[model samples]
Target: MNKYFLKTTLALTIGFSSLGMLPGTSQPIEVEAATTNTQNNNQAVAAKADQLIQTGKSLIGKSTYSNTVYKPTAPYKFSCATFLMYIFEKNGVDLATYNENYMIQQGTYVTRNQLQKGDLLFFKSKKTGTDPDHVGMYIGNNKMIHMADSKQNIVISDLNSKPYYTENYVSARRVLPTLMSANPATKGDKIVQNAYDLKNKVKISTTNNEKYLRFTAPGFVEYVYQKSGVNLGTTNLKAQMNLGKTVSRANLKKGDLVFFNSVKGSKTPSLVAIYAGNHRLIIPNSDGVITRVLLVDYYNEHYITAKRVF
Candidate 1:
């Protein structure tokens, strides 16, 4: 619908072996639920980029394209690069210029393969050159959103959807680490905020007929984090432990993922909890109830690691 960004299906086509392809649709690429990202930094970067994209998407219907006016607030008007610049500025990054030439020339150069969410993608306008004149923000699923031109409104386009972009695409730049530094509410903060809000809301799934509680420890953590926009992918315990920045037990934060070696059953780190701060953690107990437990001797003796995945 017109409510969300990218109302129309882009005419993009590519071998989405990495990203998943909908059963019948070849042009529409879906987020690969199977192609899991293991690196915590990538997850954090993707989360931040997705958040920025969602925020920018909220402005789609309200803005228009203009080369002369580069305002991003009310009655927003901007050219392709200016539009992207204004969006980044709104998201706490000041790129310092609305020009695409400098836009492509500066920032950390991201290879086509290493592109992450929130990366600035620049492309040639008329012909290939040293610097591109058009730009867009790379959202996940190989899609990017930008101000097309004066005749077109802001829209989402698949990187492979249009020949122009595929052929003219020059480079990408990342500014998330810098942005995260400037913003106090880090990804971990957002992740924990979502967890606390869902503490009471998360319930045992009624559909699954498993004998144990509605969710396994890893399943619960994945669900809570996923709802907050970080896809923890698989529900396997080892996989969950593999996510996020590993931290020492001494450096645990509010949202750090705490893993405990199996004291009763399962393998090492059989238990997991969401750090609730003040030396406390909330977990789904075997009694099928969510409760707060302290980092006592029992937990410390079996403690594994605290992961920071935002």
Candidate 2:
């Protein structure tokens, strides 16, 4: 709903030129690396596009459009930008803001000929003039799904079928390549998935006598891992240190047990959390709510070690 004018030129160039294989070897070292990265990116983008499209489609007729405010919860109500934000976050990609002008500057720019599924298309209408005031997702086949207006709510429209869309087309941004931090395999990670499901739903309080509130920091870690078919046998903090092979901080993977020393003089770990990839940790906050926090500063200074059980 925040309004502003487009600050940059919309004309963009594509940068993904393929490289030929090297001599002697079927593929050069650099070619192999580039190919691998491209393949991984393609897989990630495809999965994210499917997820975003399906989620948006599911909300059609059930959701309403609003350009004045943003509704973060269910019984969906959204603006053009906020709608994209909601669907992207639901699929583990965060667009970070709901302002169309600011969002117009995110990620890489894609030419019309290179348009792919999941690319965000920005447009300007008569009311907005040349400023980027509207946004939607390119759902392939030269079509886009957007929160058109209050009357239409959420609907799919053809880009070429409408003269208004073609005349007002401003630019497009490909965010899936950069926003989708995890590959397709990470979506299939049972440990990570289980941890995500338990976020904000479980408690970390050790002293609460409630039947459903018996989880400590270690207990929470143990429960999530156990739910994923990996049994650490005990919730004891020290016992967990020897449960799995040690993993270096640089080599840490998602779902690894990241231990930290909470007490000043304690040599062993007093707290444990799951590494949720992208420098994020899933740990219980002081209020006993399971949440995610960046693993920096305080976490960096109190770093102990990590273990990969799965």
Candidate 3:
């Protein structure tokens, strides 16, 4: 028999044995014996139930990424929100089309105490209010798989850590079908891989009349122009600049923010952007537009460390 079936059968058998009272038995000795057997069986069933629970947990933990590239059964590549959508899809749950707006609209929007494994965590940098700036897959124990700014890349993080996220904790959304599934591997692995790829491909540029400062490097420039509603490119550059300060490049990640020194000892770094893993930065240099550039070129003399903003 399959492991699941075998375990179920064993548990039932133990439960039945514990209730040792047999039909058509009026004798005191037989009744006493049945009661004793029933107690023993009950203990055995409890032990078996605990073991099965632990085994299931272990299997869930093992369902993680290998080096292989994931090709979703669906057309689009996986993302933070898309990953959850896929899990629900695989489990036979039909959701609205996979989009950021759709997910946000469908999400339950609960507090941290309501969070469980396989929930979605949202964050923002604004202090007074909770504006959704970033999204991540919550994997339990206060850890999540956020795009993690432009420098940190797609990695796990603690929700209660640092300045911005800790204070700006928005809300957690639990995708139900995932909890009902037998396997969570495909969804989990795809989410992590997609987050990593997103980090690599993030490009920062200029928009909304923002000035694009041409750095000395070929095809590279600092996106000095800032405008509303523009997507910052990489994570590294974002981490450095999120705090409006300079940080060491060595400590940067794919989704981190970056900053450059235009003026000495100034709180605001002259140029700010996101770190796109592989030594690239994305910034909004043009008016209301974001662009991407090489890190070495952008920070040749003005290289600075990064800080976590999400």
Candidate 4:
């Protein structure tokens, strides 16, 4: 882990009080927005959170952290709190807080069991002293992405498996409503468009023919989502199924992940697709390219849960 002293630098861009929505003090968070009257607004909120997570995850290994300088304009070390401030403000959230303690308390507190994707998780550390000295964003399940320290930079960790996180874990809070950009539903639409955009770009190929690799069944599915800023983690059918929020088939949305139990009549999903609004889903044909399939009979028969990963 990278080490940092509790020293402040004059180059720090934001103080604890200078944020989009300052609560008490410390770090920054995506504050809750007023309840929206339209489904579009709700979609917008989801879209923004999805984007934030994607953007944050994408920054892993690229961002550096420091206890001194707080230049968030890239090429600067980001402390635990300033790292979040940089990510939020960089992605249109407009937040500027840099105190870990102040940042975690910026949203409504939620129980551990009630935690969802895009929640702010706080931890107290000797390095930070008082309040929350360390912070991270809950991605999904028990996984989180945070700036570990000066050595590790940005990384993803399993909250359930890590003893350090479990010991220091203080609370989780909801913070996505305010960070939303306009037309988040468009993110889903773009994901759909990404699938179609590469419809014929790839075709099924095996190791014997190394060139047509991106055109494989699972590859097609993963590539489409990757184009939209979300990585499904792996191309394995079963592994991919466990990546996002599992939604009922009846509740499938445009970007919902649809799956099917195609072999041995297994109860688990064996194949997957991107739900494309209406009754259609985008899947790979035998050639390993994008094809539209309807959940009419065959798919509806083998359909499993639709997971909303983004």
TM-scores vs. true structure, each candidate = 0.44, 0.50, 0.30, 0.45
Worst 10 residues of 3 by lDDT: 1-10
- Please give the ranking of all candidate structures by TM-score, highest first, separated by commas: 2, 4, 1, 3
Count of clashing residue pairs in every prediction: 2, 0, 72, 12
Kindly list the per-residue Cα lDDT of model 1 for residues 94-196, writing each as its tens digit: 3534556655644578888888788888887665346576788888788888888766678999888879888888788766653233134556656655554
Q: Once model 4 is optimally superposed onto the true structure by TM-score, how far is the C-alpha of residue 33 displaced, in angstroms?
A: 18
> Candidate 1, clashing residue pairs?
12-161, 261-269
Could you give the C-alpha RMSD of every candidate to the true structure, in order shown?
17.0, 14.5, 23.7, 20.5
State the lDDT of candidate 4 residue by residue for 110-197, as single tens digits: 8888877768888875655456778888888788888888788888899977778988888887766532322444677778656654
Q: Candidate 4 versus the native: TM-score?
A: 0.45
Q: Report the candidate with higher lDDT, 2 versus 4.
A: 2
Write candidate 2's Cα lDDT for 53-111 as tens digits. 87677677667877665554445568787778766655655454556765776678999
Sort by lDDT, best first: what order?
A: 2, 4, 1, 3
**lDDT-better candidate, 1 vs 2:** 2
Q: Is candidate 1 or candidate 4 better by lDDT?
A: 4
After superposition, which runs of candidate 4 have C-alpha atoms over 4 Å from their true positions?
1-42, 127-129, 178-310
